[model samples]
Target: MHEGEGEIHADWVLAGRALQDVWILPGIFHGTTLRIPDAARHGWHIFWSDPLHHYYGRQLGRAVGPDIVQIGRDDTGQATRWSFSDRMPDSFTWRGETADDEAGPWQLVAEFHCRRAPA
Candidate 1:
């Protein structure tokens, strides 16, 4: 994966309103890896990851996407909504010529804001 990356955004549709906690993480070789530990049977699992290099020897996949990822529920079903803020993610990474330069790791920290669904 690259040690440097830009920002990205996406959307997700959840299952029901009963689901309480919501988390946002980027996907991996397979999206399933970012699944919540014990989340509802069906819901959107958002995520971001350190940048990675593409097969074309180019850089892509920036972990900095979406500003405030909010997942909530109404009377009918659940909803996941958020906008890509102008702000950059807490951290980033990119793959360059050196395979191992060591740049404090692309593991940038993120701010999480979660709330309960309406009753």
Candidate 2:
């Protein structure tokens, strides 16, 4: 991860048919995300929790195009959208947005351009 002049690290591991994402920002933050695919719905169910901030999130993810996947959650009238795009074997881009409602002009909250570490 990249923010201003600092760096964050992430690890992705496969577990059965699901994937787990572990994120670390040194002492500042740490979080885990689990993604499970729903084949019947052609989408994925995503769960995230950050104990450091006492935060948790649930979202549904679906592919919108060949290289774009969007995950969104609508809870208590608040909605959030996180999208991954520009995917390649070694790189991708992620964006986060929020909206008041489902049919919304989403407001950008964060963006990250990422590259995979070489083996």
Candidate 3:
């Protein structure tokens, strides 16, 4: 990621593991999965930091970001649980489901309120 004063970037490989503590300055962003000989199976999600409390660094009580989740998977690899948070805005949202198959439709799993602890 780059802040635009000068170009700086870093690359990471997500191999179906949850990532935490990925902090970077907001800037242009792009993602791609290449199929050299065949496609690979992987899962990925990003929970941004609470910019207002950047120093807290995702601390349980002081940090927050758009919270997205997925539950059971269908045969076609669609999420049986899909939800988005409007409380905390995010630059972008992504769900792994694609349009290649029409066998399954995304289903909402649950609804709940989120609150941050006093800073």
Q: Tell me, by TM-score, which candidate is best.
A: 2
Off by over 4 Å in 3: 1-79, 87-103
| lDDT of each residue in 4-116, candidate 3, tens digit only | 22122224435523333322234532222211111232333333333444311110111124554333434434334433345453222323332333345633332333333
Clashes of each: 16, 0, 0
Across 1-119, the per-residue lDDT of candidate 1 in tens digits comes to 42222223223325532222222243422111122222342333333232342211111122234432223221223222332244433432211222112232223223223222334
**Best-matching candidate per lDDT:** 2
- Runs in model 1 deviating more than 4 A are 14-34, 37-119
What TM-score, to 2 decimals, does candidate 2 have?
A: 0.79
Question: What's the best-to-worst order under lDDT?
Answer: 2, 3, 1
Candidate 2: lDDT of 81? 81
Q: Native-vs-model 2 lDDT?
A: 0.73
Could you give candidate 2's per-residue lDDT for residues 1-119 as a string of tens digits? 34642244544557477778776666556877788889998898888777898767788889887555555664344677888889888887878777886577888887877777667
Better of 2 and 3 by lDDT: 2
Please give the CA lDDT of all the candidate structures.
Answer: 0.27, 0.73, 0.31
